[model samples]
Target chain A: MTTQTKQRRKQALLHRTGSYGKGLLFMLPWLIGFCAFVVIPIGWSIFMSFNKVKIVPGGFKYEWLGLQNFRDAFLKDNNFPVDLITYFQEMLLMVPIIVIFALMISLMLNQRFPGRFIYRALFFLPVIFATGQVLSELFVQGAGEVPFIQQYNLETIVDQYVGPELAKTVMNVLEKVILILWYSGVQILIFIAGFQTISPTIYEAVRIDGASPWDSFWKITLPASIPFISLNVLYTIIDLFTFPQNPILKYIKENMIKVDTGYGYASAMAWIYFGFIFILIAVVLWLFERTMRTRRGRS
Target chain B: MLLSRLRRITFFDFALVLGFTALAAFMSLPIIFILNHAFKPTNELFLFPPRFFVQNPTFSNFEQLFLHATNATVPFSRYVFNSVVVVTMTLVSVIVVSTMAAYVLAKYRFHFKQIILSMITLSLMFAPETVGIPRYLIISGIHLNNTYLGHVLPALASPIAVFMLVGFISQIPNELLEAAKIDGASHVGIFARIVLPLSVPAIATISIFTFQGVWGDVETSTLFMQDETMRTLAFYVNSLLSGLQNSVAAQNVAAAAGLLMFIPNLIIFLLFQRKVLETMIHSGIK
Candidate 1:
């Protein structure tokens, strides 16, 4: 290469690096936070999961006992494994229900009906209230659940028809209806937002072709909303897994504060639970991609 | 699609509205229940069948809450003050940091841009429970425990906010930035003059979400703020529920406290509902 060309290329590279430096400077706060709060803590937790943690005078002391904590969580202890399985089972049923409910409500609310603002406000109100400790207290006080079951005698009727285990599951699902509805607030908002972005011209064209509303929904609306559906599915799974009411999370919290159970075991349980979440998200993403590809092929 | 047909209100529309209104009523029932309990006299709180409406609404519960607040070792107003201070500080910082980072990610061509953006997105899926213990250790290690910085710093770098802002900023036409650049505007000058003002709707939307998220947070406040005086309203309300149980007055007080914690966010939501919904729709498109 000529000397002039080489010099120009070097200057371009320098300019690129300088701009990259500026971008990094803009991102400095998030970098520091991600390192201190997210990366460091995750690394520490992984390290802690393999050891025994003890509270010392100035700080914590760790003694390495590699794989023992994981073993205890998987094989030695029963509660963590059982809780993890139950959580997965519950999420398998709950995630789809929450997503579908949100979608349906958002569709309904998307219509330009009278009192739309009121309905929207009512639906999104829960996002403000039904979070963290307040939700637990509300459920405990029977403000959200117990009264409905008692008012209709749902427990007795369901128990009479099903076996005890199935009946218990049925009752639990029934009890969770309110909580599930509460969880749909953000998803509903997202779906409604997605619905708004669907251009009216497409619907107009579909109508000119003599398609009915249902036909238009399947052909136009659903196809356009596939991205949002996947987003909502992933979001629902994460929300369910991290919910304050999840038994596995409650178990982890209990262990963290208890002297006997200790932090190492709790961290191990957290990692295992997180693994289940990762798998669930991966499965959902895989399913979503397959559906998208088939739709593309068909179209 | 049906929304475009304003002249025609069909049977399906009526049914849809009716059904959704019923659902909305059911959703709002808990809030209504809390409001009722907040005003009910102590004697009527535990009545059989749990009355949905108060027989005789009174201010005694609220009065008692104020009385307790005034007499407590750490005054109740102190919690409110702490919440306002922390939320305001966190809100301003989060908006500035997330906006700056998001602007660069959206507009600039830089090395590792993809990697940094993906990292932020991935961290969104990391459950707070998994990070709680280690985060606590870090906070204590840095001697930030019991300080507002402990509460504000960790929360200022929310990945979700960054994601949403990046999506919004990406929509701003490149031609606009190019024009500004040609006029001798530096990066900061363009960001401050063109980007910040143009991104008001997105900023407002994120600010509302951030405010509500930080305001409603209790676990972090409880973890970091060992001193009662430094706790937020959420911590105060949670403590009220857990510390005092079974007493009718306490239940009423707890209900009142929940209302106290809810009012600010409620007003904010009412004020910014349109902007929030619009920005959310815009972000969802991306």
Candidate 2:
């Protein structure tokens, strides 16, 4: 090789060595766990999905059973389909309600007001309190018997005496929204964090143009926060799906106890469910990206 | 006319503030409700009208929770201990590993830098629940089931921390690291003495998130630790509720137990609230 070529090759080797050395060293710990726990098992499960797994005295033995698990869950199992539909339906209602309510409270919390910090803490209290046990207990005890509601009931009793059915209807609406409102605290915090990132100068400029608060909110605040909203939507989906009371999770946990069913099939079923969620997330990300681009283009 | 206009703005402000205050109160009522039920006297808790506050409050329930917690049958303390050990181990492991990883990701002009970082970002979409069943089978097959190492080993490499810290560290000027190198500091030396100290804000952020995560996590503990003594606090609290929901007194006692479990998280929040919140706001800004 020419001297220049050799020199260039030497420099490239040094660069590559430094880069790979540092990168691998940094990733080593995570790579160890990931390879052992995540990558290998994921590959194993895919393999196991096509096999009949049997437990013997020594360990698990397997024989090939192509596509049967998938067939059973999809074609034969009636309950899986029912549970899947119900879960999606619940997600549809729950996600929107959480977003809107969280947005409303976050807007309110963003304003300078007395006891704002206390309110913030109070809102965060649900996060501290929403233990698996606590949620189960709250559901069983009924919201009426759940302490602070008892006080609200006293106020409603007075309202009932004054205007009966109208008051009842109003209170009922509040009650219907109560269970969900417990969890919106994190969503509110996230939104407020989003709102605070908006420069005050934007609102000031909008006001100079004689825009109404409503106009400023719609044109400025809402559009500015689309990114945060998308994030909140993703966070909420993950949170709600994993909630202790989520019927599908509860059902799966119940079935795990029976031990007659093989782990291989259960794992395959889980992967199939995960595939749906992956597609949903992809669609949302694509839509968000497109909207963000259009907005930037307009500006 | 000016007075009327001024009065109108003031009125609007007052109405707006009141509406927010009321709404905030409304939002917090359920949590407050849970707290009250958790602490109230047995008879008062069960009255037809229900009690907002106990006429005569008592700690017998809390006492019962603590007393029974260590019993072999309940394994409550064992669960608490397991949670503490696992969470602490995970927190320490993730911090050390992610810091090193993030330092390289931020500082080095490595091959596939963009691809590697983006891959880490993509991993966040795969929720723990989605991967949990396969994880369980793996743990069981490996004979790590019901073992402490089993619980701690799987989560040692948390992607969220790596993503967060990489973002935070990237903001640090490269000039700082170059200065350290000019002083003849080795990469490890610079990281230990310089990078970590300067990265306290990010460290604080990662710590709170990881701590809260491990504290409140119920699912992983449920999946991995089925042995009575191997259960985490979340599992114990869950088991206690179903096992002890018969009487008002027992329910209150269980609630007190639940509240006891919550105290540590509350304390952690109080201690690190400002730093953690600032880091969270900054980390989550994008």
Candidate 3:
């Protein structure tokens, strides 16, 4: 090679090596944490899923049961299927309600209006107020105020409007779902931000081309916001399972309190639950990827 | 014709704005309802027509909330303390660690770099919730339960934080780093003196969001901090409401407690509203 070419190659090699060293240094913390915490714990749980953990007064012991826990949770534990179904049913309604509301709010916030900032903040405030325990308190206390109503058993107009039957069903279904609206705060903010990022020029172009506001939204805003919508959907799905009031979580907590068992059964059950969630996530991601690819193709 | 077309657009804008305003009001009604109840007398709180405004607003509810904060059973103050410590520690650790990792990822062209970047991005979708049981087991085994380290340490290794910093760091021109390098600056020196200063805004954005996430999270801390005193503000608020549902005043106190727990996040949101909103948008985008 020519002297100039070799000299340039040497410079490139030095620069590359420097960045490599820096990257390795930077990644070390996450690498260490990921291995120590995430990957290993997942492996441990997979292993423990096959075992029965017995905790004596002083220490613990593990014996391989080999799918016994899974069988127990699925075939033996009658409550497991019911809890799983009820939980996903909540997800079915909650996810769509949150996404639609958040999208509508995002559209509104995107407009120029009086008290917009205050409205935005108010909408967002529930995220802070409606945290797990806090919202549970609110739910409990709010439900408590109806004691006299419950005592008198008022069959008032409002009761008829909300309806005792539907309300009870909603409460049953939403045992953990009502508090979920609070989570819309982040999703709303994200959608608004996404809406904001869509260039005004695109809207203007559509307008000049004689497209109506609805048309522009269909053509520009909605299309552009697809990626953000998918993200919010994913976030909502993950968050729904973490509700403290989740029957599965309650079951686990209840198990933890029992004198004989020390998180072994809970661990086994949780792993199964997580395995289902992983499959769901993979499907959702695949669907999102396909949708995006199709959208790109159509464009 | 042009005036008519413009008029149609204006009409559409007006209708759209009005429709959205109505929707916004409906969505915000729950918050407004809660706030109104929080400030009202217990009797008035449940009154017909559901009084939008509180009559004879009292500090009693707030006073009771603060009073409860002192109690050891709830340890509301300790919860707040735990939240502050965990959030602060997590933010600091995420910034330093993610920045170092991101610097290398952004500036380097190493083998396995693409794999590393993709793994981080993919992991962003996997929240702690999915892996909660295992994580709890891990923390329990390590005896990190009920400590600030348990609350804070896992949050530090966010894939999104690294990804965010990579985006910002990549935008930094190579010549700047090369000049420092030619000046006999070591990689660590270049990162500290050169890369760190330039990436302040990105760091600020990451830190604020990370703090918000950790501060507001009750699940992790609730699961880990079996001790009441070790709980974070979110869990304390939950406990207070759960603990006191009978007394009329206690209901009010619960609302106040909810509002109190909301205060720090509200303040953060207000102070760094633009930063938080912007970072959220950026994070959502990628």
Candidate 4:
């Protein structure tokens, strides 16, 4: 290359570095917070999980205990494993239901209609009340439950018709419908947002081509919203797992406060639980990516 | 044929409207139920087949709530003050920090931008509960426990806020920034005068979210603020509910407290619903 071209390239590189430095300077607060809050806390938790953490007169002491804490959580502690399995089972059922419901509702709300914003606001209303304490209190007070289900003796009726095990499962699913619907508020908002991103012209074109609404939904809307569906899946998973109602979190909270099962054991349980969540998220991302790739290839 | 088609369309729209109305009523029932229960007399609360409407509404619940607050050592206003201070501090800091960082991520081409963005995505997957123990450890270790900073600092750097702000700021026209730069605007000057002013809707959206999240939070406040006076209203109400179970007066007070905690959020939502919805759509576009 000519000398002038080389000099121009060098100047461009310098300019890029300068911008990089400026960007890093702007990101200083987050970097500091990430280190102090996230990085350090993660390291500390991992360190503490392998030790026996004791609270004393002033602060606490950590005595090295190797893999005993992990072993205790898996084998010695019955509640942690049961809680973890129950959480996984619940997530397996709830995640798809929440996502599909959100998608369906968003699709319904996305249509051009008068008072659309009112319906949107109505759907999003649960977000205002779906906080940890409020929801728990509402449930405790019997306000949040579907009133007629128990009053009508539906579970017993189902039990008589179906097998006992299936009846129990069906009843559990039925009971969770309200909870699931409430949890879908944000996901519905997200899906509505995603729905809005698809241009109207595509739908118009699909209509002119004689495609039915169902056909257009599958062909155009679903493919276009794949990214958002995955996003909602990740969100629903995280939200469900971390929700105040989660038995695993309740278990962790119970253990964290007690003098007998202080920070070390709780930290160990948390790490194990986090491992499950991480794996779940990874599998979700992988599945979505593969689906998207296949869809792209087909088209 | 045209008349028939128009009639069919109207019928479809009618069905759609009715369906949505029913769903809306179902969604709003809990809020209505809670508000109604707050007004019910002690005898009415236990009425079978549970009336949706209060037959004889009374202010006794509110009076009882106030009485209970007064009987408590710290008083109700203290919890309100604590919530206000912590939420405001966290809001101000989050806006300043997240906005600047978002501007850089959006407007500037930088090394490791992709990495930083991916890191944020990864961080979003980590549940707060998973980190609760270590978070408490850090707060106590830094001697911030029982202080507002302990309550505020851990949540100040919200990844979702940063992500949303980045999307919002990126939508601001580059030509505008270039023109401002040409007029001798420094980075800070451009951010303060141009980006910040143009991004009010986005800022408001984040503010409402941060406010609601911080206001409704109980676990952090409970963990950090051991002192009764420093606890937030949510934590206080939670404690009250647990401590005074089965008493009609306590139940009344709990419902009242729930309404009290909910009112600010409702007002915010009503005021900024448009802006918040617009921002959500815009973020989706990105």
Candidate 5:
């Protein structure tokens, strides 16, 4: 290359970098706040997770435990391993149900109906009052269960069909199905928002092409919403992981404050929880890619 | 689809209406139950297995709650005062700081932009409760502990706010911004005039969620404020849970307090819920 061309390329690079620097001016306030509040604390938490933490005057005294804290969580603790398994099972079942239900509600809301505005608002109303404390309080008062389940002796029948182990999870879901559906408020709203990407003209064209609602749903509506479906899946997973009533989190919190298992053990469990969430996301993303690639090839 | 000429009702319509009403009724159960519990007399509260609704309603529980609040050492009103100041400051800062960053991420071509956005998104998975110890240390270390600033600053690092803002802001037409620039508007001018006004739905959503989260948050109070007077009403309300754990009368009083606390959230939602639907297009998919 000529010297002039090289100089031109260098100038282009410098201009790109300089323009990027302009964005930093707007981001400075957030950077300063995030560093103090998010970055340093997360660093300390990760550091603490490796060492045995002791409470002392004025500061925490740390003893290096390396991977021992992590080991102890699985082998030493009684409830954690069992809780993790059940929690995973619960999430795997719940995420799909919530997302599908949200899609249906959003689709129904998308159609013009009498009192649609009222229904939309009514659907999201649960989110305002659905805090962990209120729900736990309600559960304590025995208001969350499916009353007919016990009245009709369905558990015995469920146990007979599904066997004892899986029956427990199924029965738990049945009892809290209404409560579980409450978690879909945000997801439904997201789907509703996502419909803006698909224009009415396209639907009109499909209708003119002799397409039925079911055909259009499979061909256009579902494809157009694949992007949103993945987004909701991730949101649902993260929300479920951090759910206030999560048994695993409760275990981690209890252990953090307890005398025997300190911050180290608790942090270790939290990291494991993060890992589970990350892996679940990765698998779903891979599935989405594989399906998309096949669809592209077929087309 | 409903823009069709015929105003027709089919079998599917009946099933859909029936299903929607059934689910709506189920969803409203907790709201009804909470309202009923708050009004129930002490005898009704102590009923075995609990009644779904109030049999003998009374206002005595609410009166007792008022008495309890007035009787506290710090007085409930003081906590409310502290929270008002903190919440106002926190909301302003949270919106200003988050939107400024969000605007850049959405519209700018910067190095490591994707990396920065992903990091902010990933932090959503880290619940506030999980980082309690480290946050406590950082707060005390910076000499912000026991101050009102500490109460407000932790919630400043809100990723969801920024995430949603960026998603909504990305939907704004690039040509409009170019036009603004051609008209001699600066970066801040275009944002103030064009971006902020257009993104009201997202702002409404952010404000509603932020208000609800901060209004009921007891984490900051528990970690930072050693003095009772410096804490918030939420802290006081939560403390009531553990303090009067065994008393049946306390349960009635607690239910009343809970209802009173929930009224603000309800009001905030009702205020912004119309725009909240319009805001949800931020699927974070783009």
Candidate 6:
């Protein structure tokens, strides 16, 4: 009876704490890892952004530079701002295309079919070889281009409308559509995993209620997958922004290594780049959350 | 009615099959080139017009690759071994750490939870390489430089993995977790017996990411370590390219190495694809 009373007091104490302690306990390892790896470095990066860093005997020597580095990135640097804008525009087009394609292919691949696994494997193989140098090599060898694109003389017609300069950019992206497919592998895997969470019984029940495949897709399949879609959108943006061939990254390193700009300027450029991405991601997440809330309210 | 409808082949299905076939054929082009190019002798690699298929396939490229590997200061297999150990260790740590944290973030309400969540989102904003100098310093400061810990430690804090797992783990019903609580299970028990098993698909997805990142890793090999023996196979392959830049023979040998390297990635994907299916049968419970 005394032991039972002791257990009851313990349970009451636990109820008061609301398992916050347990949550922290579970998150402990990652918390330590995060503080060690992420927090310190990010703090350093922020500090570095405002200071001139010189390589000394054992470590870097910092000389404070107020906002000069930031000013240089915005006012003095030509390529940094232009490359950042171009990357943003490219991602705005590419992210939606990749996500939608991932959804479609994953939906199909989720179906029961003969040789589906083989098809899935084939679609994903490019990701393995999509490492930078080899892909560029393949591109130089004309492997990423659709052969019919040139034969069709489509660029001439495109040039008539968008003008030559913009048309050339459009044509280049069109030619790299195969590489876009290569980029969708992770998105596809995420979508498929997400599709697993939706129960078949719900589909069956909806079917019994006389919904067509198309109707069920928009009403049932889509709403369930929105979170995964948002996740993919987030991943896609980050992936494209830091693309190995991204001129912005190259520009940052080039400026960092140069005597004129050095690490201060590069860090400044990086923070500028990060600020844009942070705003874009925050806005997208906010918009998505609003939609999610509306969907929940309707349900 | 649904089963019968499925049995009937519609023109829509036909169109879908055709579309998928076309996409697959298009996707397979580079793979075909890689497969054929790896077999071609040095002369054929640079043939004018660059023949799509090798007229005379040879194993000489593989031979050259192995011979070069053997002649390196540290044998090629040593680099391969280093990569395997690092990749395996990193994958295990990343999955375990990320999933445990994800379970809490997804289900538990705690003080500063919002901060942890935002921290993850923020980490994803900046490129990792931007912090290279500081991260290297931290590694060296911890006295982990030139060791496997340098390769494995930083990667364990994988925000994307945690993000993906939280997304996946959130799909598991709250009532189910509550039910386990009523059954007197500890957090560790619930995590091991329920959360881990239920979230196999997410694990598989993150495993593939971790494997690919560590396997093809350039930064760790180039940045953290001063010793050549501690470097990975990817660094070796990269060194080969730079060492023999502009050589036709190097092209074939690099192609051979590229082909060999990508197989592990492909196999990992295929293996995980099967794991993605394991939870579907049990997860229908809401």
User: Which candidate wins on lDDT?
Assistant: 5
Q: What is the lDDT of residue B241 in candidate 1?
A: 85
lDDT of 4 at A25: 93
- A127-177, model 3: which lDDT tens digit per residue? 654544435545664531323444455445445777864454455434333
Better of 3 and 4 by lDDT: 4
The per-residue C-alpha lDDT of model 6 at residue B214 equals 83
lDDT of 6 by residue, B155-213 (tens): 89988788778877889998988899899998889999999998888798789778878
Provide the lDDT at A1 for model 3: 61
Residue A247's C-alpha lDDT in candidate 1?
Answer: 85
In candidate 3, residue B105 scores what lDDT?
85
Q: What is the lDDT of residue B199 in candidate 1?
A: 90
lDDT of 3: 0.70
Higher-scoring candidate on DockQ, 1 or 2? 1
Model 1 stretches with alpha carbons more than 4 Å out: A1-6, A115-118, A160-163, A196-211, B1-8, B247-249
Clashes per candidate, residues 3 or more apart or on different chains: 0, 0, 4, 0, 0, 0
lDDT of 2 at B15: 79
lDDT of 3 by residue, B37-119 (tens): 67876677567755666888887787777776765556566666777777778888888888888888888776778887777
Candidate No. with top DockQ:
5
Per-residue error for A29 in candidate 6, Å, reads: 2.2
Evaluate candidate 2 and give its CAPRI docking class based on DockQ. Answer: acceptable
Error of 1 at B230 (Å): 2.5
What TM-score would each prediction reach against the true structure?
Answer: 0.93, 0.82, 0.76, 0.91, 0.92, 0.83
Interface DockQ of each model: 0.57, 0.39, 0.33, 0.59, 0.60, 0.43
- Model 2's lDDT to the true fold? 0.72
Q: Which candidate leads the pack in TM-score?
A: 1
Off by over 4 Å in 5: A1-19, A194-220, B1-7, B244-246
**Candidate 3 chain A, which ten residues in sequence have the lowest lDDT sum?**
A141-150
